[model samples]
Target chain A: MFEKYFVFSPYFWLVLFFFIPLAIIFKISISVSEWGMPPYQDIFLFDNGFKINTTFENYVYIFSDYYYIGSFVNSLILALISTFFCLLIGFPLAFYIATSNIRLRNILLVLVVIPFWSSFLLRVYAWKIILQNNGILNVILLNLGITSEPLQLLYNQYAVIMGIVYTYLPLMILPLYGYLNKFDLNLIEASKDLGLNRFKTFFKVILPLSVPGIVAGSLLVFIPVVGEFIIPEMLGGSDRLYYGKILWEEFFVNRNWPGASALAFSGIIILVLPIVIFQILYSRWSQKNEI
Target chain B: MKSSLIKSTVIFLGLFFLYFPILVLIFYSFNENKRVMVWKGFSLRWYNELFNNEQIIEAFIISIKIAALSATFATILGVMIGYSLVRIRKIPFKSFYIFLSSTPLVLPELILGLSMLLFFISLNNVIGFPSSRGQLTIFISHVTFCIAFVAIIIQARLTDFNKNIEEAAMDLGYNYTKVLYKITLPIILPSIIAGWLLAFTISLDDLVVASFTTGPGANTLPIVVFSKVRLGLSPEVNALSAILMFALIIIGLFYFYFNKKFKH
Candidate 1:
C-alpha cells in the first residue's frame, strides 16, 4: 500500500505538470491564432456546437519561412562550434585531472567545477566586461604591442561562442572526468610496451575507451547550447540570429503564439524526443547487461 | 618529465581560462568608478548601493522564497520517484515513468518554459484557479523541472545503496514504514540534502524559465539581474555578482561535502 503511494504521488505530479504542459504546447501549436487576450482560439469550441477548431497553419508558416529555418541552422552551427571548443579545452583538462593522484584529483576536480556553480548570467556578464573596448584584454594587448588599436570584440558570433564554451566547459569536463577517472591507467604503459607511439596509443586505446564519455559530454553541452538564450542576448550582435532568439521574439515581441508554439513543439520533436527515447532504451539495455 | 610539463601547462591554462573572468568580475566589483571598466581607487560603493536597492532586495527575497519552496517540494516528489524507480517493481508503465521524470533534464529550458507558460494560461482558461501567474506558477515550473535533477541524484545514491540493510530491518520485525524511516531515509539523508541544494541553485540561477513564467510582482533575482546586465553592465550588479558568486560557491562546497560524505 505504501509502495503504491510512493509510485503514484510522483506519477501523478509529473503527469499533471510535466506531461500535460508538453501536451498543451502541441495543442496550442495546432490551434488557430488571432489578436486577443490569450492570443489563440480554443481547440475545442463547445459554444460553436462541437466544432474541432484546429489548423496546421502555424506549422506550415514556420516550415515555409527562411527566417525560422535559418535561425535553427544558425543555432545548430553555434551549438556544434561551442561543443567542439568545449571538447578541445575540456578533454585535456579532464585527462590530466583523472590521471592525477587521488587527493590532488579531488581538489582539482572541485576547482574545475566551482565556477560552474557560480551564477551563469554573471559569468556571461564577466565576458562583457572583459571584451569591452578599454577592457583588460585590450590593455594587455596594447602593452604587448600586438595591436595598434583596440579591436571590437564584444557583441559578435565569436563572443557568443566564447561565452558558451566557457560556461558549458565544466558540463563537458565532468562526464569526461567521470569516465576517465574510472579508466585503468596501466593501459597506457601496456600500449607503450606494445611499441605504440603516444598518438597511436591515444587514438587506439584511450580515445576508443572514452567514446561514451565523449558522447555524454557532447550531448550535455550540445543540447542546451542549441537553445541557449542568455549568452547570445548578453554577448551577441546582429551578425547572427539563433533559434532561441527567434522563439523569444515570436512569442513576446511578435505576439505570434501559435507560431512560437509550433517552433517549440518542433524543437521537442527534432531535438529532445529522440534523445529522451534513446536515453531510456540505453539505460534499459545497460541494466539488462548489468544483470 | 616533458609530458608531465605539457600536462601541467594544459591543466594550468585550463584552470586559468575558467577562472580569469570570475576573478576579473570580482576585481572590478571593487572599482570606485561608476563606469565598470574604468578603474578608479577601490571602494565598496556599489556593494552599499546594492543593499539599499529595494527592487533587487525584493527580487532576492522572492527568488529565495520560490527556490526554497520548490526545492522542498521537488525533493519530496523526487525522493518518491527515485525510491519508486530503484526499489518498487510494480510501477505502471515504467518506461513512461522514466521518460516523464528524466526528459526535463535534457529538454531545453526555452521549450520547457514555453510549454509551462502555455500550460498555465490554458489551465487558467479552463479551471480559473490560478487567475494570474505569479509565485505559484513559477514555483510550479521550478518544481516541475527541478524534480528531474533531484530524482537523478537520489536514484544514483539509492542504486549504489546496499539493499541488505533494509532487508535486514524487515527481517528483524520492523514494518515497511518503520524500516524506511529508520534506515533508508537516514542513510540517504545526505543525498536528499544535496538534491535540495542542487535544486535550489538551479532554481535561483534560472533566468529563461522564470522570464517566461513570471508575472507581475514575481521578478526573480536572475530576471532582475539579467535585465540590468542584458544591454550593458552595472556596477551594482558587479557587486551583487561578487557576493552571490561567493555565497553560491559556499553552497557548492556544502553540496560537495554532503555528496562526498554519502560515498562512505
Candidate 2:
C-alpha cells in the first residue's frame, strides 16, 4: 500500500510523509518559547492552524491540586527508598561476585539474569501471589506458629517496594559488576600492604573508585521508578497514587488529553534535570581524576 | 571465618529472594483449589483449562505473530543502521544517531508510548494509510523500540570485527553489495541471530507500548493477563503464567545447550 502511494507521486510522498512531520515536530518545540502559553494546550487545537500560547496554569494546577501533588511526592519517595534498598542488597552480591574466584561465578550471574528474561508483568504477578493476604508467605508464617492471622502483604507500599527492587536489582548489578570486574587488584594489595585492614582498604580504595558505577546504577534505577505505573497500580492498593498512574488516569480514564500532555511534558523536565546535573558532575570528576 | 559465612549466607538469601516468587508461581499452577493461596493438593486442572480457552489461544497466536513479524522488521532496520554507522565515514551527526538509537533504552516507556500515540494519530489524519490503529500500528511501535536494541548489539559486534576480510573480498573485484552479502554478513550472522532473539523477547514482553498502540481485536497476552489480574486473580491466570515460564525456560535451556555444544 505504501509502495503504491510512493510510486504515484515520488516527491510528494517524500515531502508530505517524512519531511512535513519532522518540520511540524520541530516547529512545535520552537513555538513553545515564543507563544507564552503551554505547548500542550496547542496540541488540543492541532486541527486549527497549529499556533500555540504558553501558560503556567497547568503546572500551577498540578502543584495546587492535592491528588497530583501527593502522587508526585509519593513517586519521588518511593523511587528514593527503592534505590536505597537495591543498593543495600545488590552491593554485597555484586562485591562478592566481583572479588571472588569462585568457579560458579558465571553460573550465578546467569541465575541472576534468568528472572529478568521472564516477562515483567508476570514477575509482578508472581509477587502478587506471594504477598496476598492468604498467599504463600502468610501461609508459611501461620503454619510455623509465628502468626495466628494472615498478614496484609499485597496491595500496599511494602509490596510495591518489593516489586520495584526485585525488578531493578539486575540493572544495578550489571553496571557495578562491570566496574568491579575491571578493578585493579594491586590497589587493594597496596592498601593492605601498608597495614590497612580489609574494611579500611575497601572504604579507602574500592568504594571511592567505584563512585561512577554507583552513580550510573542509581540513575538507571531512579529514573524509571519515578514514572513507574505497573508496579504501583498492581501492588499498591486503591489509596496509593503515583505520577505515572496520574498520567494514565488522565489520558485513558478521564480522557483529558491536554492535562495528560502537560503532566507528561512536566515529568520529562523534572526527571531530566537531576540526571543532566549528575552527568555533568560525573564527567567533571572523571576528567579531574584523569588529569 | 564468621564474616565469610555471613557473606555466603547473604548471597544465598539474595538468590532465594530472586527465585522464591517464581517457584511459588510454578507450584500454584498445579494447585487444585480455586483460591491461589490454599494448596488443595496437586492437579493439572488449570493447565487443562488453559488448553481449552479459545480467547487465550487467540491472544497467544496474536502475540506470536506480532513478535515474529516485528522481530524480523527490527533486525532488517537495525542491520541497515548498524552497517551505515560502522562502515560509512564522514556521516553528519553520527553522535546524534548514536544518541537517537540509545534513547529508547533510557526513555520512560510512557513517554515513548505517548509520543508514538501522538505520532500515529497525526499520521493517520495526514497520510490516511494506517486508517485505523490495530495490528500494523502496534507492530510498527514494537519495531521502532526493538531496532534501537538490535542496532546497539550489532554495532558492538561490528566494532570488534576485523576489517581485513572485507577489504580482501573487495580487493578480489567484488562490489560493495557483494562484499557485504558474501563476507560481512556471514561473519556477523551470530550477532544478528542474537539481536533477533533479543528483539523477539522484548516485543513479546511489552505491555505499555502494546496497550497504547493496540486497537480493537488485537490484545496481546501481557495486556490480557494485566487486565485479568486487575479484576481478580484466577487459577487460569496462574496457568497462563506457568505456560509463559515453561516456554521461556525451554528457550533458555535450548540456548545454553546449543552454546555448550558449539563450544565443544
Candidate 3:
C-alpha cells in the first residue's frame, strides 16, 4: 500500500526533488568524462568511444606533487593538533560541567551552545578581526605595555588552530558531557576510599569509562576539521593551504571537474577510513562491555 | 582544594576565550571612530548606519526568507522520515539507510556545496527546470542537509516515545492518519519545533554552501560580511554582527523561557 502511494502520490515530488537531481548528475558525469565510465570502474561501456581502465593516476598525482602533498600534511597536522587541544581543554570543562551544581548545569550548557546559533562565518570573521595585527588583542597588548609593536597573530598556523578549536570545542564538550553525566560517583568514592589519589582515580576510572565519548567527540571534530575550508582559508591566508582549500581551488578556481572529483573522492576516502575503523573498534568494545 | 581552584580558573579562562571576541564585537559596534581597534568614545553611528545600509538590509531579508522557507520544509520532511522510521517494522537496511541519510551531518560543507553545485548544473542541463540557479537552488540545498539533522534529532526523540497509546487509539477504529494527527503529532510537537529551530539556525548560519550555490545578485548576509572582512574590518560589519548576535540571544532566551513555562 505504501509503495503504491509512494509511486503515485505527491511524495514523489519530494523524492524527485531530492534524489533525481543527484541521479541525473551521476548519469551526466559518466557520459561527459572521456572514460565513458567512472574513473574507478575497470571497463568502458563502448570500445571506441573512450578508454576506461582503472588507474591510480589521481592518487598518484595528489601524493606525488609537492603542493598537494604539502596541503595534505598541513591538513593532518592541523586537525591532529586542534583535536589534541580540544581534548586537553574540553575534558576538564566537560567534567566540571557534568559534576557542577544541578541548577547551573543547564545554564552552562546553554551558554556553550548559544554561540553555535550565530553565523559560523561571522564567528570566524570575528576571530580574524581579533587576531589581526592591528586588531583588539594587539591594541590591548599595546595599552598594557606588553609589546613595543603589534604582534603578528593573524594569517598564521596558530590562528588557524585557534579558529578550529574555537568552533569545534563544543563538539568535544557535548559528548564528553554525555559520558561524564552517566559516571557513577560511587566508583570514584570507592577508589578514594581504597587509598588511590584523586588524580589517579580520575585517570584510571573516569577516563576509562568515558573512552567511548572521547572517541566519538574526537572523530566528530577531526573528520570535519580534515575537510574544513573556511577557517583555514580566512585565518591561514594565501600563503598557507590545506586539502580543503586545495579541493576548493580545483573546483572553483581551476574548474577542473575531473580533478576536483578525484580529489574529493580520495579526500573522503582518506578521511573516512580512520573513522570507519574507529567505529568498528568502538562497536566491538561496546559489545564486549555489554556482555 | 588547590586542584579545585585550578579547575575553576581553567573553566573561567575557557569562558573568557569563548566570549571575548563577541564582547569585543559588541563594544566596537558602539565605537565612535571608524578605526575598529582603537578605543573611541561610545556612539551608535555604526548601528544607525547598519540599519540604513541597503545591501546589509536586503541581504538580511533574503537570508530570513530562505531560512524560514527551508526550515519549514525541512522540518515537515524530517518529522515524516522520523515518524516512518520509528513506526515501521521489518524495514530492510534501516541502519544503512539511516547512516546514508545522516552522512550529510558529518560531510564537510565545502564538499557538500561543491557536489550540490555540480548536481544543480547537471540538473539544469538535463531537466531544464529551475532554468537559472539562485534563491530556489540555495533553498533546496539548505533543506537537503538541514532535513538530515532535523531527522536525527527527531528520530532520537521518537525512539524513546511510547507507542501503546497510539496502538490503543488505532484499536478503537481510528485510521492511521487520524491516529497520527490526533495522538502522535501532539506528543512529538516539541521535537518538531526543536527540529525546525535547528534547521533554521543551520540555514541561517550557512555560508560555504550558500556561497557555492548562490548566484549573482543573491548574496546572503554572511557572504557580504565575508567579502567586507576580506577587504578590512569595518565598524558597519561589527554593527551588523552585534545586531545578529543580539537577535540570536533574544531568540535563545525566548526559547528557554517558553520551554520552561510550557513544561508543566
Judging by DockQ against the true structure, name the best candidate.
1
lDDT of 2 at A241: 86
Per-model TM against the reference: 0.99, 0.86, 0.89
User: lDDT tens string, model 3, A153-179?
Assistant: 988889999999998888898899989
How much is the lDDT of residue B30 in candidate 2?
93
Mind listing the fnat for each candidate?
Answer: 0.90, 0.32, 0.35
Q: DockQ for each of the predicted structures, in order? A: 0.90, 0.40, 0.44
Q: Write the per-residue lDDT of candidate 2 for residues B69-160, one digit (tens) a residue.
A: 99998787777667765676544454444444555666577866765666677677667767678788789788878877888777777776
Model 1, stretches more than 4 Å misplaced? A47-49
Candidate 3 lDDT by residue in tens digits, B242-262? 889888776666545533442
CA lDDT of each candidate? 0.94, 0.76, 0.76
Looking at candidate 1, what is the lDDT of residue B122? 84
**What is the TM-score of each candidate's chain B when compared with the real chain B?**
0.99, 0.91, 0.92
Question: Which candidate do you rate higher for TM-score, 2 or 3?
Answer: 3
Greater DockQ among 2 and 3 belongs to 3
